[model samples]
Target: MNKNNTNSDSSVKTVKRNKTRESLPPKKYQVLEQDWSINQDGVNIYGRLYLPQNLPGKKKAVILSHGLAGNYRDVTKYAQYLAGQGYVAYAFDYPGGAKNGCSTGVGQLNMSIFTEEQNLKTVLNAVRNRSDVDRYQVSLLGESQGGAVSAMLASKYPKEVKSLILLYPAFSITDYAQVAFKSINRVPDTLNLFGFTVGKNYFAKLFNYDLLKSATKYNGPVLIMHGTDDIIVPETYSEKANKKFKHSKLYIFKHAGHDFKGKYVTRANRLITDFLKKN
Candidate 1:
């Protein structure tokens, strides 16, 4: 049996073996903390919480979901900055998927986005049910495909989601599949095309789904941020959703690529801070 096919260690949730991120130094954020969990759904995930050193009386909270093949640290820096400005900001890594299954080769980025039911469930549980947390004021922020999951969640529970901030969200799964097909044509037909899967596309058994189509059903305040130079997800995806949403806010960072420009980091943080404050 493939080592990757074996079940996880059952004990730890999102067990990340490497602790040395020498390439990226921890940012100047106020406080960094993590709480790993094995949810009832049997998924291990990382609950990375960024708190303000000095607690604010009572403030809104934001839950962040990172991009494909990403962990909590992917977007925890943004959460830290938000916490610095007085918000309960949180993010997490998918259980088993990050450290164990991912290493074993049973992991797929595309599937992780849709399979994030456990991930989102854990996040909401921590915020709404936490003794010191506020339920009604919780918002969500997602990047890349995480944006797609967040959009679906916001639509699924419109009343619960006060607002959504999508950073270069994956608008269409088929778009990527189409591109992959074109690339795969290079290989001979004999090769096992679906031999192994590494993204949400392989799982979820997806044909096609548009993030904009999902967000249109959501009536909450929406903030869509994108970069003109983003070749990965493209800027049009964000623009399309902005056009459909009744209360959508769009921020285009010029000359920015797949990752957002550092210059607009503060601006993006401010926008989310203000949106969550809305009644």
Candidate 2:
């Protein structure tokens, strides 16, 4: 990438390396980063589209979703990697998803799983409608809260999603909401959570949501990765999901936490690419 051209749509072309790690293969094409934004419910959802130069015909695409309060930049690396592997990649910021997000409208006060779900659907439809994308081969990859959103969408539109990949998904959110307030009557109108001010709507749908049940509705292949030491969202949630899905595999990283780190990230990426290729 050219340091001076980072912000331009036609600016960055991923640099290729002569040597590659045994675990990670060399990129197939020079990836180009472009600014791609879409309008949803009268507001703009800012995002980036990574296209592999000179790919013939319609290409398979992947939609990368960030975790709660995270922006598209947080998952930019994944988009670059997938684009390098010959797949078109997209990463976007959800409305009101982050304090400093590029997207407009909605905020922490009213952002909920349901709202995020709608945001993802809008992205999926836009990506599918692209002339260069193979609508039938689009996949969804998400982290934490975004993972839950992806799973729910895959369940609702199984035929549209080729495969699903979840990284330390927040499937326990529904249960956490119940335990936090004990019941709906005890729910407060507003509260500070993880440095964000949230309202009752944040937990409204989650109160009666069944993540695993909704997730298992999608009969497509699913790859679930979780860390054994994750305290924020215990591994048990993923374990349960793995068992419930008809065709799913779960990989547990020894020392990884809520988000992967060090070699864990590399291993997870390899697994992700492999799964996408086979599925």
Candidate 3:
């Protein structure tokens, strides 16, 4: 009887250990980074692709876009995290997207949202064509101006986009442009705004495009995140944009500003991971 009892206890211990091991998350795959160049209409758009090592099969992919005047490095952390999670991540710079970006500089003097959208499309096409990427599972993640561009792209190509994640999207660009130019017809050839020399084409394009209307066309799963205290892009814009999406979730970080950091970034990453996993 004593021997039987000891054997039963050992069996229970082994079962419990196995169960615990099963409950633990899988080990993260090693990530490799590579530089890629995507040509849009003739301009070289530079980007970084994050690939997971030791993956058994092709994985889902995400194309990340930086905010206005920002480069691919701005979203490197997100790319790294997604790559670790077994998703191939790509971050690209729009032509003249930033003053110091790696892409061919069109200069802020001629940069416009329409041009940026074209660049994004080029990157998406390049990503979709890669054998290691699951074309049907590609998603877009954009910040600020890039968020607006992503939303527009998803709307324009609903069937191609699996999901969208917009962080503090600048949906009020047209409204802000109206305020800056006073009269759209009177926009100068070049004007300075926020320390950047923006061209009249930028304001003209914003005046003609309706971001909210374009966003309404995309009915895919959308994740919109904003900071309540963000002065750059008001939380209300995100709130209003959320109402347009057929399937959308809005997260407002308390006291968080336009840029996320520290605990806030961690929180955002968690929310993003959960959303991606579900969709």
What pairs collide in candidate 3?
none
Q: Candidate 3: lDDT over CA atoms?
A: 0.79
**Model 2 lowest lDDT segment of ten:** 6-15
Whichever of 1 and 3 has more TM-score, that candidate is 3
Sort all candidates by TM-score, best to worst.
2, 3, 1
lDDT of 2 by residue, 55-80 (tens): 88999999999988788987877889
In TM-score terms, candidate 3 sits at: 0.87
Best by TM-score: 2
- What residue pairs clash in candidate 1, if any at all? 44-95, 108-198, 108-199, 109-198, 109-199, 109-200, 110-199, 110-200, 111-199, 111-200
Residue ranges of candidate 2 with Cα displaced over 4 Å: 1-22
Candidate 2 residue pairs that clash? none
Error of 2 at 175 (Å): 0.2
Q: How far does residue 270 in candidate 1 sit from its true spot (Å)? A: 2.9
Error of 2 at 126 (Å): 0.3
Give the per-residue lDDT of model 1 (tens digit) for 174-242.
Answer: 466555554433423322222333643343334345545655567778887777778878787776677
Better candidate number, 1 or 2, judged by TM-score: 2
Q: Tens digit of lDDT per residue, candidate 3, span 11-93?
A: 10000111121222333988999998876656898889999999967789999999887789888878888888899999987
